[model samples]
Target chain A: MAASNIDPAIFEQLQAKIDEEGRIKDELKDIIQQLEKQGRVTQSILSRIHNTPTGQLGPAVFQPCERSILTQIHLVKVLSDIASKHPFYKWNNLWTREMQNLIFCLQLRHWLAHQELETIEQVGNELGVPINVKDRDIFHLTIEEYLLALTNTIDELTRLAPNAVTLGDFSRPLQISKFIKDIHAGFQLLNLKNDTLRRRSDGIKYAVKKVEDVVYDLSLRGLLPKQRSSDDTPAEAKGGAGAPASDMDSDVFLEG
Target chain B: MQMAGMKRSRDGPKPQGRADWDSPYIPMFENFRAELDEHHDRREKIIKASRDITASSKKIIFALQRVRNLGEKIPPPLIKSKEYSQHTSTIHERFVSVAPDLKGINAYRYQRQISPGIQEFMEAVLFRHYLETQSILSPSESAKLISENVLLTEDDYVLGLFDMTGELMRYAITQMATNGELPASRTGGRGNILTGLQDLRTKLEALDVSGSYGLSKNAEQKMSTTRTSVEKVENAVYSMTVRGKERPKGWNPGMDTSRPVGEVEG
Candidate 1:
């Protein structure tokens, strides 16, 4: 044993490393806070989707939604710029929830206009970023992030199905129903782990069933466009705000 | 799985002039399925490798514990033996095998899957370094043990250092019991196990990682555990001193005989 068994400089260096990590997190947190603020405004703008009619959705919802999403896109670039300098997962927790929210906004806006789930590539294209990067140590939307966002978009559209019918756009509910079922079916293809993404995705079945109920209610009243109907008992449709309570109606969602 | 073959004829003519399919996103999902599967497979590889690395590291620590003295090579019988060789090689092989999966961006991507092994390895390496040199293992020295493809974050390193303190405490207790004295220099210098433990405690206590993320979040529990370890050694040393006069002739509380103490730290 030497007079100095442990060097003082060792702890000093460790402290320096700890402080450096703290500094990086603070800088990233500053940008994430800005992203979070922008994300909120974008969400407030997009929430207007519920009241706006299908025909008026373009000028009323799409225009404002796209503008807000563009602002969030800029903050995302700033977040990504600083984040790229460090390991992706080191500070991913600081921004992942907000990033997922931003992705959901993009997916929702794209879906409203095009009536198709925005591909991860389309999401990256609109944000001016890379999608599902495999090799590079750069900022990109991961597949898990994209899938989580897509599931969130499906949840949003689930709320929209019945709203579209409430606004007398009888056909919009049918479109949303098909789209949500498609996305839910997409989720079924994934072999998910028991994590946050899996839990969020697991709820997609409920979203599927909810949208199915809206469609079933519409078709029962002869409100369907007279094509490809899965008939439900009119008596059962009168109860339960289009809940998939009966095994018969749930079978429609399962098989479809 | 096949895309549902059912017709999309019922959904009001497919809202956007897009060609209707029962599920239009199948091609997109097929791509996602492949990507996710690759991610999971890579994740599983790291996880299994991590498990082996962790188990081997624990065994290495156990083997190192058999040595009775500090500031020297692990005795030939304890470390140069076949069992020690197996643990060291197992750790090396597992680390090398998992390095490619942890390369570049994926290093941090699969950190959750791989971090447990790295932390345990750090503890073993740090303990060995302390036992051999009676000095702290710098982060750079630790970096040499880990592969270049793997990223070792400061959080893992600090947490590993925290765990190493418990090993030191155990070593001190065992030494005091076997040798009828605290593990210290024959010259009675301050560079003994208790001083080293207190020095470590002071440094760890001074750290200010208060946030709810990374090291700070885990530091709370580990810090308390570290505190308990130091106190255990302190209490054992205190009892030995208070009870020294009452012991039977040549009777040791933790030792059967006092061997020739190592001459160190004049």
Candidate 2:
């Protein structure tokens, strides 16, 4: 037999590397699965907002939600410890979704309480992780991931505005409308490529409109707590959710 | 759950009120827009560089395909040819330009974007390595040859080796047709290009990449093509052996033997 040019050791080394990476992924996945469970718990608790009165939300929603979020944060720390030893992006896909979910939960909770967007730094500080890390390879939250969380918050808040009205909190829709519209406006300023962020950000306009509809419904019935100096003129219904990009500008709402 | 598989749908339209310009989140999102825009710009640069690298690597392989012998240095004249130099430079330039974008934490971030170019470059590198050394190039050596800035994954190394087998099949068939023999080591070694290929086929087949996530899908895809390439060489060699006495000199062995034999023989 002719001498083999391939060294058997080479394939062995590669197998070893593959096995090692699989082990790391398995470990991370174990923790991520735990994280996913906690995320669901948090979401289930937060989803109570649709029916629960806003005053009761502190004990019924935020408290339990925060506890679940903290548990998720602990799991993230465990994941971060194990993952930091390897290339960040190499195994990042394994946990990016979970991270996005966890951060979205944080953003949602913060918005429900504070009525403003959660800063990435605040998220990093709360989660005990770095945000937008660029200097060296280590575990950190990415801007895209946080932005994804913001988009999630926008979607959640849109749902909340309509529900808040149903719960007899008629003024809540105005705050939500302004918040989402502002968020949508912020998204418009971005030079987004065709990616998840772009797609999620694209939904922001719809969210802006959804909250506007709630506000408009309230104003039409004179349920608005206070009328604005300018006429309470609502822009056309986003007209259609599928309205192209150009259709968004005309969907604008004027403060009553 | 809200973020999972967030698809952009045309939900029913809501009202667009005049946008609140003085958004409290503007400064924060502006920072995001700047950072995201920079990231996208960097990604675009890397992607552009990657495509250029792929193109240059393919051209290099085209130049390398002209070589008539193996297990020795590529002819200096061919290596120094202007066309070859241009392609080599282009590959280097493309790789160097995107090198920073792929550094440290960002290495694996742009991995998907840059992988095709790396794989194509690996194919060219492996082909050249085999043409000169008559052996498979190891990942470390490949890493050294590529650039210090780029990380060469084992998947790229193995996939490139698989494609290099196709180049070998072509090389063997062309050589056997022209010279009536397989190119083997002239230094009293038992190894010939066909034996080396068969060895690679067996070696690669034996590699346990099933556990690997990225490699499992891509390696499985390449395995069948690799198997066919090795088989083509085997068939060429078999035809040459069995028909050695009857076939006219310089006749090409192809899938259709009857029609082109005389044309090739003359």
Top-TM-score structure, candidate number = 2
DockQ of each: 0.35, 0.34
Candidate 1 lDDT at A119 equals 82
- lDDT (Cα, 0-100) at B229 in candidate 1: 94
Off by over 4 Å in 1: A1-4, A226-256, B1-22, B187-190, B249-266
| Model 2 Cα lDDT, one tens digit per residue, B1-266 | 13211122212122233343366677887898889888888888888988998899999998998898778899999999999999999988888778878888888888888888999999999999888888777788889877678888887777777888888888888888777777876774648888888888888888888667788888887889989988988988888889766776676777335675445552
Which structure among the candidates has the greatest DockQ? 1
Fnat for the candidates in order:
0.52, 0.61
Please list the residue runs of candidate 2 whose C-alpha ends up more than 4 Å from where it truly belongs after superposition. Answer: A227-256, B1-20, B188-190, B255-264
Candidate 2, B12: how far from true, in Å?
20
How much does candidate 2 score in TM-score? 0.89
